[model samples]
Target: MTTLPTSTQKKLGLVIDLDTCVGCHACVVSCKGWNTENYGAPLSDQDPYGAAPSGTFLNRVHSYEVQPDHGQAALVHFPKSCLHCEDAPCVTVCPTGASYKRVEDGIVLVNESDCIGCGLCAWACPYGAREMDAEEKVMKKCTLCVDRIYNENLPEVDRVPACVRTCPAGARHFGDFADPDSNVSVLTAERGGIELMPEQGTKPVNRYLPPRARDRTEDVDILAPFLDPIAAEPQGFMGWLDKALTAMPGGR
Candidate 1:
């Protein structure tokens, strides 16, 4: 096993908001589209068109129904990716030193050319962030769009990770966690952000903002009319549709 550097200069990572995420999979697609091309190799799909299609992806979103002991069932959207941990066990488990963490920015990455595909990194990660590319026979994980973030050719505003840029709900955020005043840091502090499976002691840089609290005291009327004033006051688009329906041959 290898050893990580004593300390990283800066911690650049993401802060995901579970409450705001709608599980739209926009981030997932954006990450795949960008990373597959940004990095040297394309993301692989063994049986893309087959009955049981599967592919390697850097970003994954999962939805879970959490029924608390004393509260209502909450639908939570969880987005997972390489957390770029401080004491990354994935780095220490690499026999060939292919898996390593950047000393300057704390981004964990793999040297594909030197990789042996031992799957040790995947086993070392508690969050299940690593993926295996069957064709390349290499272990892969999220690079945090390292190429995009540092590319000077791209527009100034478009230098973020594709997942962050394409998140329709603004659920994903990117910043330097080392800065206590950074947006990611403030949001984490305010929202009580947490690491996934922290017991593993990886000290993951990426933080997850738990679902926010909502008021459930107000009751919703389940039997309410679908359309309000549809026939009583025909005014706009819905009114025109209602009027046309009434003027049909067998109209009511």
Candidate 2:
């Protein structure tokens, strides 16, 4: 008789708190550190110090200014990466059978040794989740730090993914999404969390809680740090430098 494997007791996943994110890059850096150290090859850089800089990363934080044409500007910083979809297109499209989902905990993984680097999985993803490792010649994306999460050798508090552990603002979380009582599930429910590109219907497991609204006029300066303002062309030494830089001496 044909029989499917029994699902595990938990479906592990992540829930991100946009309200608390503070747009810090700590999670990004932590992800880089962990993935580079453990994944087959480090996230490679192409022309890193040269023009047209690019690299492969499993996680990237995207800063967006979400202003409706008639409304106030709301800045949103999204950390983009694999959502590890339940109906992941990346899995089915893998001609080499490298991409797979674990029925045990629902975390998707790529078998790097088996990958042929066809990039079919990359095209199947609408979120642009997958990237090719130029050096390894294989597909790469988030593993959710699978080795760390289930490692019995680590301390209980450090068992989560590196990104979740290093987030200074407590913006990221890792837990069993199948358990409604789990922290991830509860937080998602409480915040009325949203999923990105839901229309694509990949059934992404990650959730993003929206940021709280700020009073446009009163709280605008709260965003000043991100804007990086400098003294506007003062009438002194700095002003001279600024004018020199802007006008370019030989220019008309």
Candidate 3:
């Protein structure tokens, strides 16, 4: 079994905003595209065009309908991936030492060459973040786009996880948690970000900003002003018309 470092030089992770995410799946598509093309093995799809399509993906978004205490029900989009926990169970469970975390940036990764297609890591991950690539017969998980983040050849602005760059709603943020003044740190502090399953003691570096309470509409009449009569009584030409109509035998 592998052992984790006592401390990482930098705690690099993501901060996902549940309120801003629209469940567009753009981050999902971008993660699949970048990892398959640039990372280790290509993520394969089984019977992609057929009925039961299954594939390996590092990132996924789940939506839930939740009723807040102060507002009506709301739909929250939650994006999940490897949290790169400080005490990652997946790393400790790997018998071959294939799964490990980087001391430099705290990014957990699998050495595909050493991987024996064992499902131990998947079972150990409580968040269900790891997946077995059917075609490659190897375990796959999020690397935080290591190749992209540290590549000096790329533009400075593009040196982040593909999911963050491609997120249309700007719900994903990547930064160093070790730096108190970092963007992710400040955002997490301001938004009151919470860790996923903190009781598990994984000490996940990633944080999630909860969705804000929405306004209640059950008691509000949006059209009340427009629906009100312009005048209590008819005036101008309409008054004469009303008098003329009242004079008719059938008029009310």
Candidate 4:
């Protein structure tokens, strides 16, 4: 079994804001695009043109409808990837020395060259972080864009993971969680960020920001606050359009 370092130099990972995420899947698309071409292993597609298309993607998003204790039912957009746990089960379960955790940056990575594609690592991961690439005959996962983050050829600002870089709603932040002053750590403290499944004892580095409270007292009309056909005009096209819209269900 692989043993983790007693203390890592830095816990570098992502902090995602569930409240700000719009379920747009921009992070998903961007992650697939960049990582499929440039990272450790090319995320392969198996029978892409077939009726059932499946590919090796590092990031995924799932939407869920949930009713919080005090708030109305809301659809939550959840983005999932490798959390890179301190005591990663995938690393300990690897028969080959392919899976390992870096003591310097605290990033868990799989060496494709050493992987045998036995599927033990994937089965060990409770978070569903590992995926086997049939084409490469190896397991692949999110490496935090390790190549890009440390590449001196790229600009300083362009070093973040593809998912963090392309999020339109500013929902994703990347930084060192070990540093209390880092943006990720500050955001985690301020937003009450939570680990996904603490009972598993993985000690995942990535954290998720819970949904912010919604104002139930503030009554917000869905579609009627701006309709005023009578005040605009009786004969104009604007008046006619407004009247037509107001007649629809919940429009007024």
Candidate 5:
């Protein structure tokens, strides 16, 4: 058996590469795909292929347009998920001990068998990490693909979580945060990473490295193609009428 490093006295975590993430939803899709099949259930959309659709996800990529005081606009993609905090409120607030942090690794998990379908854990989490599994009447969150990560049957290179493996831009990493010499540790040290919502004092193990300084000229050039005045205007009276209608309060 391949034993995990002894340095993992404390739980390990992930370090996301924000600079390299392309805002592709591949990680999200892969997460839904892997977890749905392996875990209790796949993330489900209430109205899939319909007018209004939404569902649960352990991972999600958020796109933000960051405008610096003296620089050009930057399109930043943030993949949000459970940081698997050292002082996880989700675990403490669980009245049924359903939400627990793993002793073997730092990964937090929900035991559906023990859960009472109470939403307290969801309310306690500031990051919106926990989602209700409506079908099972239990809270659901990321498992970090515990089954696959250490599976001896899988190839050595495929041991990482599905989200990390599907990241085309190479923005996701999984490793032991407890090990000072681990790859995630080394990357965070070199990149001067920052944690989200540090004020909450959950002591999240995951880190997000700030995006690199981008060139203003390049940013403007990227946005220039969609800004043509001629293209912005529509064809004929119907177009003008549409714009006028949109001008009405909350019409747009």
Candidate 6:
């Protein structure tokens, strides 16, 4: 079993806002595109065009319809990926020591070369973040776009996870949680960000901002204005039409 570092220099992770996400799946597509083209082995799809298609993806979006106590039902889009937990079970569960957490940034990663596709990591992850690559026969999960973030050649603005960069709704944020002044840190505090399955004792670095309460429609009359006429005496084409209608059979 692999051991976790006592502490990390930086806690780098994602902050997702459930209210802002639109369930477009743009982040999922971008993650697949970027990881396949640049990072490690290409993600494989089995009979992609066929009826039963399956593929490897590090990121995914799930939609759920939630009913509030006094308001209407709302649809929430939740994006899931590796949380890079401080006490990651997947890391310690690996018999080959292929899974490890970096002390520098607290990013849990699997050394693919040493992986035997034992599926231990997948089983250990409570969030269902890990998956077995169909073609490579190895485990795959979100690396937080490590190559992109640290690449000196890329623009400073582009130095974030693929999902964060491609999120059209700006729902995903990437930053160092260790820094109190970081955007993710401030957002978490302000929005009351929550951990996924806190009872699991994983101490996940990633946080999720809950959706705000929506306006209730029970007391609102949307067509109230239309029901009442704006003018007591109609004029122009509308006036002519009203007069004609009134003149017709039982048209008062």
Query: On residues 1-252, what C-alpha lDDT tens digit does candidate 4 reach at each position?
Result: 266677799999999999999999998898889888886778889899999999988889999999877657999999999998988889988888889999999999988888889999899999999899989989999999998799889889888988998999999999999999999999999999999889999999999999987756667676775664555356678778889999999998
TM-score of each: 0.86, 0.80, 0.87, 0.85, 0.81, 0.87
Considering every candidate listed, which one attains the maximal lDDT? 3
Our model 4 lands, by Cα RMSD against the true structure, at 7.8
**Candidate 2 ranges with C-alpha deviation above 4 Å:** 1-9, 68-71, 215-252
Looking at model 5, residue 104 earns an lDDT score of: 76
Q: Residues 1-252, candidate 2, lDDT per residue (tens digit)?
A: 011124545678788887777778888888888888885668888898998988888988888888877677777888887897877878887777678888788777888888888899899899988899877788889999998988899999999999999988888989888899989899889889888789998888899988876655644567768888765658788778777887997744
Give lDDT for model 1: 0.90
Regions more than 4 Å wrong, model 3: 215-218, 225-252
lDDT of 6 by residue, 18-93 (tens): 9899999999999999998886778899999999999999999999999877557889999999999999999998
In model 5, what is the error at residue 154, expressed in angstroms?
Answer: 1.1
Ranking by TM-score: 6, 3, 1, 4, 5, 2
Clashes of each: 0, 0, 0, 0, 2, 0
Q: Report the CA-based lDDT of candidate 2 relative to the real structure.
A: 0.82
Q: Which prediction has more favorable lDDT, 2 or 5?
A: 5
Q: Quote the lDDT for 41 in model 6.
A: 79
Worst 10 residues of 3 by lDDT: 212-221
Please give, for residues 43-69, the per-residue lDDT of candidate 3 as tens digits: 999999999999999999899989767
lDDT of 5 by residue, 111-150 (tens): 8888898899889889988899756677889898887798
> 56-147, model 1: which lDDT tens digit per residue?
89899999999988778999989999999998999998999888889899899998888988999899898889999877788878999999
| Model 6 lDDT, full chain set | 0.93
The all-Cα superposition gives candidate 1 an RMSD in Å to the true structure of: 7.7
Alpha-carbon local distance difference test for all models: 0.90, 0.82, 0.94, 0.90, 0.83, 0.93
